[model samples]
Target: SKLFGHLSSNSSPLFIMPTGRTLTRTEFVKRLREVISSFGINSPLYSGHSLRIGAASTAAKAGLPIYLIKILGRWSSEAYRRYISVSSSTISNAFVLMSKI
Candidate 1:
């Protein structure tokens, strides 16, 4: 099984520092900024919230029900609607697929 996969070799907690301590929110944000900046995205708009938005949008694009996406995102309110961004092309493709069905 995947339990013995090389990626799972580290027994430490999934989110930890080199010293095996859980990362502070500040440190996590700093590291996230660094990684995003390294990719030549100098915009400060990309934060942890971006990850949530991306997940919800990706789930939506994959044809997952909105209710399921809400649950997967652990969203408590309709605010989740603001997180999922569906592009025009995605909607067009969905319409074409549904027409075939």
Candidate 2:
């Protein structure tokens, strides 16, 4: 179906299956939870959705251009704007760089 079609074309091995079984949302969440648990991180804030948010946040923090991040995350400009919150340190670092230039 639609999900299988999407997965078939996905480039990430994380999204593929040699068995041809599509990973459902529930399965994905369960796997995420298992991974987190294996890492011994008991933080309740970590979840499947957090993975997506964290990736986008990391990309933003790493100075990846907003336009590039928007496309990589498959988010609209508005949606990406809402999700990416630049940390105070990021702003401070920018200021320091400007001072040295």
Candidate 3:
């Protein structure tokens, strides 16, 4: 019996324990840590929210428009702006580009 497997007889739930129960937040976090650690990221600081932040940061770095980034992140408020973390070089490059105009 797999702890997290779908019973072929049932197809409603995408993920469920052998007991047909959804994972609690703690269990989910533990599994998240295990997966992260397997990838050589043993940091205890990673959480579910980290995924969201990473997505926003990556999109911002990729030069996606702010409106599109907000749409991709499903952020209705300006809170998504805070999730974007740009490198100092990016800022310096922006200033250089601005001066060219």
Best by lDDT: 3
Query: All candidates: CA RMSD in angstroms?
Result: 5.4, 5.6, 7.6
Superposed Cα RMSD, model 3: 7.6
TM-score of each: 0.67, 0.69, 0.69
Can you write out model 2's per-residue Cα lDDT over 24-100, one digit (the tens) per residue? 77777778778888888874556666877887888888888877676667665567666677889888988999999
Q: Using alpha carbons, what is the TM-score of model 1?
A: 0.67
Alpha-carbon runs more than 4 Å astray in model 2? 1-14, 95-101
> CA lDDT, every prediction?
0.76, 0.72, 0.79
Candidate 1 C-alpha lDDT tens digits along 1-101: 45334223444434677787898767777889999889999847777788888988898888889777776666768898898887999889889999998
- Write candidate 3's Cα lDDT for 1-101 as tens digits: 45123332344544469998987767877888999899898649898778779989999999899987876666779998888998999999999999999
Candidate with the larger lDDT of 1 and 3? 3
Model 2's alpha-carbon lDDT is 0.72
Clashes of each: 0, 0, 0
